[model samples]
Target: MAIARPVRALGLAAIMMWCFFLWTIFRPGAGIKGPGDSLANLERDPNLDPTGEPEGHLVHTSDAYLPDANPSARINATLLALVRNEELEGMLQSMRDLERTWNHKFNYPWTFFNDVPFTEEFKRKTQAVTKAKCNYELIPKEHWEVPSWINDDLYKESVKILEEHDIQYADKISYHQMCRWNSGLFYKHPALQNTQYYWRVEPKVHFFCDVDYDVFRYMHDNNKTYGFTINLYDAPYSVPSLWPETIKFLAQHSEYLHDNNARDWVTDKLRRPSHNDQASGYSTCHFWSNFEIGDMTFWRSQAYEDYFNHLDRAGGFFYERWGDAPVHSIALGLFEDSSRIHWFRDIGYQHIPFFNCPNSPKCHGCTTGRFTDGEAWLNMEDCRPNWFKYVGMG
Candidate 1:
């Protein structure tokens, strides 16, 4: 009887243990909740489906994982790059950084332009790396070729003199073509017509900050016409005739010059154009154009189109090796209010020796540090210290 009683107790204990095990495995509040229950219990997003299912998928709503608005519809913009087949690798590096920093979340489209057709390998490799929509187009030969208006005899003479003086890219005809295309022709490209805004990127450029917000949206909302990262003096030797021509244009078309402009930064105390040397003429301070975000409407406007055409007719792009930086600066100086031009101090950019690094720790992952007091270039006569002063950004 005693043995039987002990056996009975043992059996009851076993039963209780089994029941607990089953409860732990299958009960309503069991070991781990199912996906549906877990999702249902989560804090709901204001945008979440009231029925707790979004498009037949489990809704995993939480403060940490809130529903995200699609950035594409909000941004009327695209990333533009002018690259060659050989520049594919360098461009990919820049693209990868761009994705990591900003574009991955937004999935903005990218348009790559080349004077010649892109190679199959270049296309395949670039598309494989990014999920964003990628388009490649060949620039028309007419757009890239030297215009008939340019005097071939004079251009040859200028190139000879520049080459003798060892000026950078002076001997390369392609460089001049590139400068001219960027200065006036790129906005007219058929592929870019639909976009209201563009962010121009060059090969091997670095994106240092994690840009969480939409830059395009910001521009749209703020009514900003132009954005730039670095401001420096254009090589005076490269654009000696550019400012004088600009002054002449402004004088004749007084209506084009904005009443509120940044001309003081680009011009001298005499209210005359100057160079970095503080000469009686231009200070040559211009926004570096390699990294620019701008409203396309600004470029398509008559003011800019006329300005570019006037400059083109002058033959300085071919003769004096004029660059797009000074050309763009001159246009903005004349057409837009100084207040509309934005300095992207948060962005970190580097092109060889010069860098526009932000002081913000928000860019901790950047490869380079901030431009410091020790930088000799910052104090150089060519750097736009006065622009910094005028803009109250130094």
Candidate 2:
């Protein structure tokens, strides 16, 4: 079709304008020297915004939204921490040195909990030794003292029983109190209020190799709520055969009573094959509560509080040399679903009564000839048949 002269001229003008605008906006800008401009100029020139931070970057991107990206994350556990209390001069210094690598490298904070006050020299010196924040706290009066509810008579009876059996540290009421406090209240510290993960450290506990990744972070990240070393010393005979009472509580109260965490810990033949899961009504009782990394909320749960209170009311803490380890392990077994109590086969652990090593270099040293059978590690299995089997006869 033939176009009118004025219309054709207008159309040609419109095309030219469109081409000019596209060239200016879509095409790359040229340098003052030539038609080709360097990307460096985009970065150097603030107006150009070469980084394009608003858009995004390939690496080292902003983590403003990440929970662990800043200080607040330490509480929710996007970033987590571990702290140790060092007592006495000898084991204290050695363990402190071992901690330097883990603390300095990870910048994890360490809080030294002691019943006796830390001296001026110790504080100044320890601060200098660790780049991490070092806090010294005197064990509170509430933590150290035996509550009035504790029958002094029962306490002495427990001590006498231990003496007769020759169990070391049985006579030390302070040690018993320490165990109770560690399991019951250590995380209640104001400084740790925000922390979701914690590693309890005694004075001489040592980490041998160079640990690059933050263990607290790993536990928190992977949902490996509880980690520990040194299994054994979890004899049910050690606690009151309170299974009748405890099992009744579980079946009536919690749905996850015999969950995987409970099953694996109490029923696994690898850990406690002969444990009586059925007697405990398939309860999860085979757990070692000490040397553990765990979910803080797990302890804060109503189940734990009730269990601790019930055990306390029963006077188990005073009536027996009730170590917090067994108590804590039992609680984890009973209360948490199998997904919660995690076994760290790689952690090296040692104690009296011995356990089948999951991944301890001390595996060759599992020579603890005394409590050789899996019964050495107490659980529901010791009381019930076919307890260690994952699947029940049901």
Candidate 3:
């Protein structure tokens, strides 16, 4: 009886130890409760299913994974679009393509701006296309209107000359306003006040690849200031005075230039002999701004503001068809580090008349090697080679 009592006690102890071991392994938040195991951490983990569902099970929820929930996990960015009410169909098409390619997974908010109020139909259709929140904002009049400092007669004469030369949108005042606003004023909008990064989406553009990762987070983590897919030479005739004006600005604010600037990519200084004075001229190479993923703080800086004011006061936006593409490119090439400006070669993008298709497994419905033609002239005009050489990636 004594031996049996001792055996029974030993058996009870063994059972209790076994139960403790099971609790350590299978209790709620047991082995997983360590670094990066908090509820917030699990919610922010892109690889994990936050709903706690079984693997391969789909869970539908109306609530988006708001970046505000865990600010450290995501970037303060938005997909920004400047559109008019009349172009609702084109906007919807762009929304559909982007959603299908990328945004559907991320659910980043869409912020739309217009000089006028967005129509109910425009709002409804755009919101219907995505589960993300949609914000509609009217561009303030002061931001869109022609500055009073501009000479009316001089502007009119310049437009007539550009029209005579068959320049695109030369006679349209609205185009001029758009160019000016996009160049300097877009970042000033109250709607974008809270946003640090923006991916500019234009109407009727194409997104041809599955962007499985978070682009905004990539930009933030990689220290990238500006990202672009297409690079092209700007029309030299359109901005006759832009280069000269940029030279003057550089001379005045030489301190603003970054030590490792990409100025050589935009000029022939490195290509020509050191003694050549004419090599300092602008190459007219620029990033196509129709599709831009940029850090807004770069535009909001005092240096950029001063540069924009200098150009704005020069009246080139109206007197000449000075595009925002060149303006933005020039600023980034001079002020930001070359390494910080990223060429998004993995993304397959297309704006009308051109394609930035990449030879990537993620891309679909596009032919690779379509970025440039075989003609030597076309290839020389392409800024990609120069950019590649500048970045030492070619």
Please provide, for model 2 over 228-337, each residue's C-alpha lDDT reduced to its tens digit, 9 standing for 90 to 100: 54444244344444455565566657763644544343433333333344324323344444356678888888778777777666665666656677667667766665
lDDT at position 246, candidate 2: 60
User: What's the TM-score of every candidate structure?
Assistant: 0.77, 0.62, 0.78
Candidate 2 accuracy as lDDT: 0.51
What candidate 1 gets wrong by more than 4 Å, as runs, is: 1-72, 269-280, 365-370, 374-378, 381-384
Per-residue lDDT of 1-394 in model 3, one digit per residue for the tens?
A: 2669889999999999999999888865443312332223322112111111112222232234543344333457899999999999998888999999888777888999999989899989999999888999999999999999999999999998777767798878899999999999998988788889999999999888777667787777678799988778766667768878999999999999998887766773332223123223777778999999999989999889999999999999999899999999999989988878877766778887766775656777865443233344233445665565555321
Clash-forming residue pairs, model 1: 273-281, 273-282, 274-281, 274-282, 274-283, 275-282, 275-283, 276-283
lDDT of 1 by residue, 183-244 (tens): 98998998887889999988888887666666776677777798887777665678767878
Give each prediction's root-mean-square deviation over alpha carbons.
Answer: 23.8, 21.3, 18.7
Clashes of 1: 8
Output the TM-score of candidate 3: 0.78
Question: Which scores greater on lDDT, model 1 or model 3?
Answer: 3
TM-score of 2: 0.62
Question: On a 0 to 100 scale, what is the lDDT of residue 35 in model 2?
Answer: 15
Every candidate's lDDT: 0.72, 0.51, 0.77
